[model samples]
Target: QQQVKQSPQSLIVQKGGIPIINCAYENTAFDYFPWYQQFPGKGPALLIAIRPDVSEKKEGRFTISFNKSAKQFSLHIMDSQPGDSATYFCAASIVGYQKVTFGIGTKLQVIP
Candidate 1:
């Protein structure tokens, strides 16, 4: 089952704008939620993450808001720059599980 779902296949933003990406999961067993940022020709790298115990987390210009009961999460990039253009993905996994389920991904373009 494709438990993770992402929205807005693509997004466009001007420099210094904020871009938001959202995701949802179906499996209650999923306890870990992580968002990844991928630039062309590179592997996805962890950007930020949160556990169900935490409602939200922020690091640098990236922030993650999690809703435990709704089984949903979202990522927001503040002061987005042209260099921030990339593909973002949301993922869900069990604490000790080897497999991680990923969302479809959102391509963000920050225009100067």
Candidate 2:
């Protein structure tokens, strides 16, 4: 099972609010978990990532909470801003060059 599902198709948050998106995977073979951020017409960039060995990971304003047993994960954005408005995608990949499976994507709009 090499499938990852994400929810909340879209989200809106006021400035300084925290927006959260959730994702779940069924492939236990997946060892690398990465969240990607994409602006309009831009390539997805790695925002923050967490390995199976860690329960959570954070980078600056972005945070990733993971649950291995439940095969679930979520991304948290702190101090939401209009500039933070973008599409976020959760992805999973194997050790090698295996294609990274991506979530349908969540559109986040931060109101000023």
Best by lDDT: 1
Residue 35 lDDT in candidate 1: 93
* Candidate 2 pairs with clashing backbones: none
The sequence of per-residue lDDT tens digits that candidate 1 reaches over residues 1-112 is 7789999889999999999999999999999999999999999999999999999899999999999988899999999999999999999999998999999999999999
Put down candidate 2 lDDT per residue, 6-108, tens digits, no spaces: 9888999899999999999988999998999999999988899889999988889899999999999999999999999999999988888668999889999
Summing lDDT over every window of 10 consecutive residues in candidate 1, give the lowest-scoring window: 1-10
Runs in model 2 lying further than 4 Å from the true structure: none
lDDT of each: 0.94, 0.92
Q: How does each model score on TM-score?
A: 0.97, 0.95
- RMSD in Å for all candidates: 0.7, 1.3
- After TM-score superposition, the amount by which residue 35's alpha carbon in candidate 2 deviates from its true location, in angstroms, is 0.8
How many times do residue backbones clash in model 1? 0
